[model samples]
Target: MPPALLVQATAVELLALYRSRSASPVEALRAVLAHVERHGAPLNAFALLDEERALEAARASEARWARGEPVGRLDGVPVSVKDLLLTRGWPTRRGSRTVDAAGPWTEDAPAVARLREHGAVLFGKTTTSEFGLKGLGDSPLTGITRNAWDPRRTPGGSSAGAVTAVAAGFGPLAVGTDGGGSIRVPSAFSGVVGCKPTFGRVPAHPASVVGVPPHVGPIARTVGDAALLLSVLSGPDDRDPFRAPPPREDALYLGALVAVDAPGASDALDPSGALDARFLRRVRVGVSATLGYVDLPGDTRACFDAAVALLRRLGAEVEEVAPPFADPGGVLRTLFAARAAHTVRELGPEQRALLDPAVQSAAAQGEALSAVAYLEAERQRAELALAMAVFHRRFDLLVTPTSAGAAPLIDGGALPPSFAAPFSLTRQPAISVPMGLTSAGLPLGLQIVGRHFEEALVLRAALAIERESAPLRAPPLRAS
Candidate 1:
């Protein structure tokens, strides 16, 4: 097979190849290893590429397949993980030099365990910002992660390496964490699909704190891949206090799309995957380019307006709706800072020095927040959540530009845009779909959001738009 073919195949396609015996799972693993070594110079996406571990797993999977034994859905497929998540054999530095490489990691995170149970071949660990504190994938510990589309541009962050690996085909899918658009920002900038499932919808213990809205999510090239990954990751766990009860309807999210347009689906008693035609026929969509406050890029407004027009053209009722709450960013910052301060309060001065400047600054701010100020911020968070609840009651879906604009060049540092943090605050399920390309050839993305825990609707709406929009192609890996 051509190297370019390896670059373009999706997780679903790889599964089909394995099932049909067209390619041995071990051979597929080798393809991933070869590509990683070949593209490492240009992509700079990986923190560690475990060739021996991945190939061994792949060979074992192939053996299981030969024996006609049961295997996990993702069996034999190579996948990368964000460095923020711990893996037993691999040293998880989380892009921070302060972390001791020899620290014990005897247990897998719930999501990591699920991936292993599903037979995913863990290819390697991708880079991350120190403690995932910043948007751009740059840290003093790990060098900057550049965009695959343009080596000069950023791949987006704090899930920077995960996004870059997907774009560069180090793997077909990646597991990422989103505290404040860590998953969505990179997905938007890197021209991949990013899914932030409703908070507590996935098992994310060993990472979650008291009330923070951090979530474990999937970053992939297509909605199907994202859904497949989500399925593998979503479930209850004893370790996580916030693990939500399993959805009443346990269906494959990727398969949900196939049933979306089927006859009688709209009228079906179960509304899980089916769209309400009456509702969708003239879907009420609220579009906001600037979210009523933040400044947006010139092209951001244009592309968003264009997307709104496209939705209207598709027979949806599109209008500009002011968000119900005010100044979510301020509240979010306070809450984040407070959480950061508490989480890292135990680190010694020497360990703290190794943290990113942004992380340190946030930690300091968090430490200084008075109880009254923190409570006020908490109040604002509740108010914002209610406001979103009311907003979605009126509109079937909310639409906005995924990022303020295209991915920035990885130089000093690329910051996360205002659009992502608010939704994280709201804990609404958001999907970042590639909308179009800018004249500069950078990918522009559109974000579709749904009510809390309404990933079905969010994915359906995104798929509808994706069906109409041009697919985002992977950038060719070439020498810089």
Candidate 2:
């Protein structure tokens, strides 16, 4: 395959290329590095690129592939991680000028360590919002991470760089964290697949300052790729107090992917990449266009309705449903602000000066909350979770727009409320898959939410939708 095509290959496709000797890991890694270097500047999607380390690992993977002794599931595949996570040798600046760049960067975050263990060619760290505090991409440190679809637009952030990098073919897969909508919002905006596995399904160390609401997840062009990476990232890690127990013997992430493509799977279980509609039949899917709070925009509503209709046509038992609980927006805001306050309080005056004003404002809001108010928010959260738990008793899945609309212009209105904050509050597994693009060509993601630990079902359902929807096209850089 040509180097150009190599840069666009999916993780599964790249693995096949390595196994067949059609492409070496070094060749693939170099191709990606070049592509990212050439086209990545406009989007400013990368925080740091470790070319030497990535190439060295790629060479070793090439040797292993030559001997038919691949190290693990993601052997030879180049992957990017959001900078919020630790990387043993790289500074995790978290897109904050306040973070020191000096020595003492040690230990990989659990997810990063797992990527290394799985033989992934760890390459780069993507940009993120300051402490992942805001919704749009620009941070005082990394500047703006423009949407790949149109450099003028915002790639709905905190995981801004991760989603843009994945969408632009910087790498086939990226590790992203969602505290609120970090992963899914950016994925929805950038036209990539993003999944926030049930809280703790993928462990994180030094627990997120945002508390139990944040989750580490995967970003990719295909649901199968995300599931493959999730399998590697999901497992017991003693460092995370919030880690989920060992995955049930019956509920593996990749098993879901394989089942989603059963008749097409081979001994190698190579992801077919082609969409299959065999899944989702008889699956009870509940649809909530607005979650009964935010006013749904006309364009996004039309797009979402079309996608939901398609789900019904695919044999899903679909039902229109009212919001299960009262609007939790205020509760979410309180929890979010309180966490921001906790994080900001630890910073010294000098470091605080470097923080984004939005972060400061959010922290200030948090600081004003009395202990009683904070507890009230927590109480509301408990009630909201219970509401969803009971509501799911009747529906196998919940579908909503990942974001209220397409990526907004960088200088225009903010990306509308994703209606995603509520599900994040529930700590259930949810995925954002590209359903289609707006008439103007921007991507729109359809979100699928599932019960706790039901990641496999989420992925299976998303894969079916992905297989049936019109595939999103590459950005202009590679456009025909």
Candidate 2: clashing pairs of residues? 275-467
Candidate 2 per-residue lDDT, tens place, 320-395, comes to 9998898887888899898889877878888888899999899989989999998888888889999999988999
In model 1, state the lDDT of residue 441.
Answer: 78
- Please state the error at residue 253 of candidate 2 in Å: 1.5
Candidate 1 total steric clashes: 0
* Tens digit of per-residue lDDT, candidate 1, span 1-480: 565565567776777666667676788878877777778777788888888888899999998877877377689888888998878788888898888888776778888889999999998889998878777878878888888888888887889999988988888899998888889988888889999999988877574663355789988887767877887888888888878787766453644443333322222323353433332556788988878876777776777777777787677788898777665778878888887787688999988887888889999999998999999987887788888988988998898887887887666545546587788888888989888777787888889888888887677677667666677666868853
Q: How accurate is candidate 1 locally (lDDT)?
A: 0.79
Q: TM-score of the candidate numbered 2?
A: 0.95
| Top-TM-score structure, candidate number | 2
TM-score of each: 0.92, 0.95
Q: What is the C-alpha lDDT of each candidate?
A: 0.79, 0.86
Model 2: ten consecutive residues of lowest lDDT: 258-267
